[model samples]
Target: MLAMALSTAPAHAEDGYELWLRYHPLATEQASLYRSRASQLIAGSATPTQTVTRKELLSGLNGLLGREPTSSDTVTSDGAILVGTPSSSPLIASLRLDTKDLGKEGYLIRSVTVDGHTATAIVGNEDVGALYGAFHFLRLVQTERSIDRLDVRESPHIKLRVLNHWDNLNGEVERGYAGASIWDWWKLPDWRDPRYTDYARANASIGINGTVLNNVNAGAEILTPRYLEKVKALAEVFRPYGIRVYISVRFSAPMEIGGLKTADPLDPNVQHWWRSKADEIYKIIPDFGGFLVKANSEGQPGPQDYGRTHADGANMLADALAPHGGVVMWRTFVYSQTNADDRAKQAYTEFKPLDGHFRDNVLLQVKNGPVDFQPREPYGPLFGAMPKTPLMMEFQITKEYLGFATHLVYLGPLYEEVLSSDTMAHGQGSTVAKVIDGSLGHHTLSGIAGVANIGANRNWSGSDFNQANWYVFGRLAWNPTLASRTIAEQWVRMTFTNNEAFVKPVVEMMMGSREAAVDYMTPLGLHHIMGPGHHYGPAPWDASEARADWRPVYYHRADRNGIGFDRTRAGSDAVDQYAPPIAAQFNDVKQTPEQLLLWFHHVPWDYRMRSGHTLWYELVAHYTQGVDDVKHMQETWRGMDGYIDAERYQQVAAYLAIQEKEAQWWRDACIAYFQSVSGLPLPSGFAPPQHDLKYYESLTFKNVPGYSSW
Candidate 1:
């Protein structure tokens, strides 16, 4: 429906401070059509949430329709937009819309005749649901959807849709491509930045109900009284928008902050300290969303330090928060340098045995893949393995491995790939989406978290195109099964122009962008070959890290014979972690998906591929194709110079230029390293690397943005 083109004139320069909530005036025809249906607004201010819902509706309608809707207690005119729950508004209660099935956060929007006047009712079971409904209604208008004969009933499939901010207390965000942390701890508890409210609004607009406000590699200082007051201030600002604030807590906080002798979960003293801390936090921020723990992984302290299991650690925190109606989101990203097992199988091995060991309030937050957020990976084995435990899907919205902020790698496709993966735990149709949505496991508690790309940058994310990653993550977190292509199209319409010509190519670009990244960066199941520490660019030969797992060479394992990790039964037996069907597929080199052939098996350089080409030849082809795709993306973007605002269009064009250059760098560096290792001649008609292997290896970055040290 979004099919209007811009007039042939110099459009205004729009710095992307507005994000997807950019309620810019619609095209003249679309505005007129929408205005007719949203002539008047009837919403209550019975609570803080209802008040903000009314404010947002008026603001969005005014911006989109070129006029504010008339505020009325009753439907005085045809095409009035009515919003609220039964308890909040008398008009909504009189409609007698069956909201019993809608639950606390679900909403129903329908066209109904009230007092002989035609009106659109956005009713929900709760005020927060109505707020969600209001945002949905605005989305329909922004995307140019018809409001007439509306009968949309929507609810979040997952219970807790959250954003995990890897932000530190001192204004730094680990793996954060955007600027510094937006929490503004220095000014908080006094000077509340307007950006905080905007942040909450943007999150609530997309149905993200909670946010963990600090880095998962947390510091003990966050639990201190000073920081609690600051966190309390943020909770207040976000509360009106129905977003609860969560904190990532250090497992050793009982000793580091509480002045206890031991932080053991089994100790009565340690339990009492945590219980008191929970009480203190709840008293400060009553609706606080509870703790996100990253214990015994990557040098972070946890219950393992005290000889307790992951469940023991998580349940302890869960018990502390249970009386307050809070939850514990325990991260399952555990891998030990001491253990000589495959890194990908460690999380599953540790948690699979403790399926029902965790308390009801505890959610095992698992990354979408077994490995860290590589451009591509098989869905995490833990998704289906631990049926009794509530597994929370954690996706990284920030392009940490996909060229940080510069590359226009929309992650919707990647998310779709992982979510739609057939885990085959229960049967053929069992998907990771089903596992996390609680449909497969039948768990009452469920969650999905996106590691946030948000920051203090005006555009929120580092680049203009990068904002699409954040938008897509939030939309998909609400309902994981929704097509990524559909979400991309909706985002394109809402963020930029709705013109058919502009929308078609741009959506295609976004949908294919992730695959393009996977192709160039880690084609054919190549994983974690990025530079050590910063992970900025290709470093396949980087064997300099102190730990073997931290080295790029450790992951690729390229020798004179082959270039791949052998994760089959002959190797680490990592394939056995998946369900039987998946394990069988991954174990046999012939049966495995070509994309994941290298991930599961180490093949000879001359091994035959499904394409009838040698493995080495296919690798070279995939790398070359990735570069070509980026070039194609540049060409497609160049054609739309006049379709949107010059500022955004030009910036995107510049970023694509950067992406093309970097894609070439990845292609060249990787090919050079692999060629050196495999001793293979380039297939006919294929170009050699831009420089020699030595030249690629000599390159070093002193200051990459997203590096945790920076």
Candidate 2:
């Protein structure tokens, strides 16, 4: 039986404004069972967090069970839920559950008998943890899990699970497809949007404890007193939900805001200015998380401006924030046009030599791939390479390269693939997950940041499915070992419908969505071929850009004889950056995974693939398969009309239609360009490109959304 049966809600449609917290009424049988188990709530409301926790439980229960459970101080009823910390509730303290081992943010939910009345106890070491537990309890009811013998204990493996917003001060979000920035900077510091509270609730429910508010390509004005007050107002709203706000800092802020001549890291005046700024910020927002710096990359100012190392820049800010318990997240997405070597190897080349030079509070925030957020790429070499330094994974939740918000690309599988990858730093079993969780390096601080796709859209993420990317990112940050399929199943049940027939196929579709995108877009490790600036559609022939690395032709490097970048010993030698075992495997063309064949080696067009087909034939097959997969997705969603509200269902249906048309556009364009380069005919039984090479090359996009004006 479906947990949340077909909605008893009025025929009025849903606009997906409620995300996964939709606590629609459950089926008769499920509701009766859950209502009996939740007859009374005995959670305390002494603190602001406790008050919100109580409010959430009441709201969720009222919606899910069709009525609010009686709120009480003591568990006199048979099926009461007693939730609190030892200090907050005497009822919880009397139970004497083993909460000593549970960390400050960890919680234990167990069934206990108090005064001969059977009750569920949600115990934590802190109020925020109890709030988390309350959310988990609501999830159980939402997902129709049995609460009869509940003994669920949960804690975040990563210390700083944060969302990195690319929102700018001008209210424009770089690479944000949903809408304008959600901050409403003009109205903030005076008017706190109720949406901010909902944002905190959604993040807290998934165990994300921190958020970087501004773009890493930051502006100096954000550091001024006026903006600091605005940030303080937003912090107050998020504090109750346990979310500490962080900001991306302009590296030359001392020069721009403090009226300093030079913002050198080693300069005494510069150091004093940063210290004073930190003190000022802490006074306004005491629990403020530290700076996220994109210095020395993409024209951002940094220590490099003063001929100092990345460590010099990061440590300078780390010192100022150390007294206030803040840490600096220094981005490792550094590349320069001066360096002629592979763009993929630049981050490792630059940061590897500076290992252990950083302060203990500084985390080297590395992207999942050595390159930018490509549709698919190998795990970054820095994961294991920087064992002496604390490294946090930075994933792009925005689908900038994967058809923006229109394409149904579930990033859960992509995140899981990167986290579960074995870095092999300490022989075997040293996964990327271990590296970031402080287990591999035995370091204390750990974190993972997702470049948030959230905007002012009613759905939060641009589309209903895009919300799953945000949802899964938080879930995996809490526990990296979780299966993407499991997360997808949970999201499908909560977001749309719990009907088995509707859920099973939708989960399957989501699981394969990323791979389908990879096949259609950048198959066989061909990365960064999207249109320049906006990164909308395929632009395999786009080479007019002034910089060699920024052009599409720079990456694909297609020629009349063959295709693919040569990163072997004879070429860029980028494979040597990985561990010796991984290097050896990638060095051998036959040994490298076919999915990443083009990433490491330049193979001839007629070379035989593992499938015994020629390289050209395999490419055509994969592209064809991708289009077929999107068609299958369309077919799958077509049957889900009545499963969810017509408004959301029809919107999803329309987006899928758009995705199919664009997938075909990607297929036809790429095939035309590659065929023109390789001088190869389309494989037998395959359809030729709809247009000639010139047509695909002539395509131009204007006024495209999410362009990085900065």
Candidate 3:
């Protein structure tokens, strides 16, 4: 049905040059107000940072407001927009803003009288804050909001909002869906691309101030002097946008790059080597954001290789960087084969015991889920378990599990689910957002990092809709309290048309996308059912992987009599990790939310659901409903043909077609395999699988795109 809708549309434009920053012309009224208020600008001294800020404001105003603001030395009458810091301009000082409260990165925008002229002023404590404020002002215009009577003061809720790019030097991106890696390592130090500058602009537009530029499956060569120069060039490009570049330092860089016998933290030679490396990096890039380490996980080397703890490894790097004001983001995605414990439980077990042992400069980067980014896993136990340690929430913005780039799954709701969850560590309202932002734990430093899905694709993210996930992540990382629906509305208004006709349907489609995906892929919390290695599609019958943990059966634990992994006290007791009230709810089958029914209980096929249908029938209905929802989305988008641009409309229509096809594939494969095991007949009026179980099981694609070895 969706494929038909797309086939009727014209071919899409191949150029993806305009990312979400596409400042298309607004309605007549919006364009008029923007042009009047942002007609001319009087900016202070033109430093490198200020130049970037001026160019951005001019370009965005030209694109969005239908007029360019000319730069001026003095504020003119009536409608000039003034841009400067308190230290640079007397006008800013006279405004009497609480600049002390804004820190270095915060900004204030006010309509004030400068030299008896009514002018709008964007003032900040520093030049970088001015750049941020400039972008904020542009966003309001881009979204077609009034600029008159502007009185806005903004500060980031979290100190560090960073994007962790899993981009390798060889041009392959780990779990990246858009295209090949954006970094062209072959032509680096001398041949810097303008796209790098645009990338920095996009990050600064949202409140993201830092980026880790290498894969966590890191190469020691990144720390070498040769690559340090390459990294310095990238850093220089990003510096003006208030972005600090960080690297994923291979844990054994001391051994591989420094020719050390052992990369042990306690070894004086290794400690000295790391300190010298930090000095070398800081010398080139002064504000280098420091290291992101994936130690003792998936064959990655760490201090644990020598019977030392994670703290020992992190603190060693922290000591090296403390002098340079750098921090270490030590990843807590570790699990040991020797321990034979649940992978979900291993990270908490390893790090919870060493809470206060970490240096102040070190942050424990924990994944949003206990396991890998499954469709729906309970929040990782590490959130509230470590009070003394600053834990940064690591969210995968890439759709590795939720049908990769093909499916239109908005992840804002998923992020909100985890952030708003009551961890109950300190009290009733101990949300995960509080834990990461240092409010609940009362820690000095706080941060949140998103695993970037950005690539060389013209649209930045692979699909047009995938860009929303990236946008929402940055927005939520800036202010975790914002509702997913609100973000979705704003994104729709900016990315597409702001017309109620377009925004309402698109927002509705986006709001239900994740749940629709969960329904088709891992409904009722049955997770880890994707194919091994690539994780492209459903493989519930898969059980012959090299490690028991890698197989789908290890997660689902389905049998002829019943389905689901019983994580109650009788089973793994994973529920015991949560607070008492939450733990007790998850432990009881009757009390548990139906969304997480299969996560906690092994239920019979005939178990009655609250909806009065048998569990098996309800599962079938959910999958069918998910497919129907995709069909509905296709219809809704088709109705919006004249509303959006022809190019984007066709592009999104085509992707929706692909999504509907894959959703059917998921529904058919999962139902066939489940029914084969359950030995139950398809319920009356429920559609049967289009293909046999064996036919669906035999599906394979050895050469799928984006499955790069790097």
Candidate 4:
């Protein structure tokens, strides 16, 4: 009867809807081992966080152990899992674990003795800490780690690890590839979706504590009373998971949403309007995180429109949120056509001067690179230059420039590269990681944000490998020092089979995937040459756009004399933004790393590369190398059919085929264009493109998905 009942319970095939929380029944040996340790639950707390902790533990335990565990106030039997702070449970109090320095969100899971009973205690200083501990405990079993004699203490290094969703009010997502917006704004205040709770669970499992629900290119109507009620509903669903809600505030909300005449940051009426708005938000959602502002960039109205500075605009909102303990994530992605000297140097030029001017509650959210999220970019110079202000790193988990979701490019290596790059602000050892983690500058407040790639898709990130990007971002945000390779390995083991045969090769493929994308799409630091408007395929010869910087011809100045942007003192002098030693290296063509050679210098077509080939030959070789890598990735995935679910396996297989074709398109079109400019023959023994230059240029994406944001 018991076996029959178990079989009758509702279950679905693994279509990746469960994400990494797929607590499927483990291998017989592992399941029995975990069952021996987690036979009963002894959760003695009833608070909201504790309730979720109890619920999660029971669900995970039932799925993995193949049977539900009995909940008990006291552990009368052995193999009991005790989860709660000392104050909430007598069993946890008797163990007397030292949780003093664990902080409010940190926890320690240990094997301890209580009342002559041997048990595993997930103890913390608070209930939310215990909740985090619960997720970790399940992860141990899911990853098939030994639970015997466990003694682990964990805490988040960064204070505000968050996700910035570019989802809009009307079910559209800017640069979002997965699907339509998940937030059903029309039915949200009344019809709360169960998916919202699942989203919160996924974020909390990975230590992501906050989310901005709207796009940074914000709509002011989102600030009105109607939308506030919808935001409050989502916040209620997320509150127990320790995730707070934030909004992307349009800088001119006072004028657009309010009845103010002039939306100047210094204007008395504008300041008063913002303070009242803050109070209104706090009344509905008491723990609302704060505002994320993008001002005076890309036609967005800002303080610069009112003859004030970026600091003035940010400080105005910062003052309003101060009384409520909210903050301002002032974006530094500012650029204008008037100052179109170097797109790579614009953010640093603007924000570096106002280093110490921001209020204590405001954080300057700088992108991982100086320019937009290219396939590969040097660390943003503003990271180390601003010491007095808290500089939060903003990474894009979405694949905007790197083939969107169709390409299997893992972003772990990309994140690791920017974080590990040394800034030399406090001498030789100051990595960008230290600067953002508040260790190098000794600033109390610190954070890291990712432009979330999540949407309404069932798989959540469009593809299985793409989920690794989202997972890695949250993991890195919690602790920037963690290795990307390590995170990739863990994600693979949990998301797929733990079998070593599957884990090793998949990790190897992921570790090199980003570099592969870079070699083909934007090798040697060639940036922003994708198709205009839709950014789908190659368009290197495109120069017809009105704005000079918006066109591909402006970035890669390929001519008969040379084929690169010169950022040396004679050119745009963008290399001068870096620290003196770094700038000196970048200014010298011979000293610049070959990966970034084209980014910093305008070299001759006949210039030699370290690979013993002319620049023309080396460039062609990189494009072909990228195409070859995609072929290799496809071959690797074809052999791992039994490791993961058939649905995800086929989805990844189909996407890899798409990537291979697109990679070839990039290689051929870019080569054809550069050859036309340099007037150079193809490298000896190298075949010409599949089509002529005009043929490649004639191909267009008339209706690309996820393009028309407006």
For each of the candidates, the C-alpha root-mean-square deviation to the true structure, in angstroms, is 3.0, 2.5, 4.1, 2.4
TM-score of 1: 0.98
The TM-score values for the models, in the order shown, are: 0.98, 0.98, 0.96, 0.97
Which is the better candidate, 1 or 3, if ranked by lDDT? 1
Against the unseen true structure, what C-alpha lDDT does each candidate score? 0.90, 0.92, 0.87, 0.89
**Candidate 2: residue 673 Cα off by (Å):** 0.8
**How do the residues 70-114 of candidate 2 rate in per-residue lDDT, one tens digit apiece?**
988877879999989998888889888999878989999999999
Candidate 3 per-residue lDDT over residues 405-517, each given as its tens digit: 87899999999999999888988999999999998888878899999989998778888889898889999988999999988988888777789998998999899999999
| Better-scoring candidate (TM-score), 3 or 4 | 4
Ranking by lDDT: 2, 1, 4, 3
TM-score, predicted candidate 3 vs. hidden true structure:
0.96
Clashes of 2: 0
* Model 4, span 544-618: residue lDDT tens: 788888899888899999988998999999888888999999999999999999898889989989887999999
Q: Highest lDDT: give the candidate number.
A: 2
lDDT of 2 at 147: 93
By TM-score rank, best first, the candidates go: 2, 1, 4, 3
Clashes of 1: 0
State the displacement of the C-alpha of residue 77, model 2, in Å, after optimal TM-score superposition.
Answer: 2.1
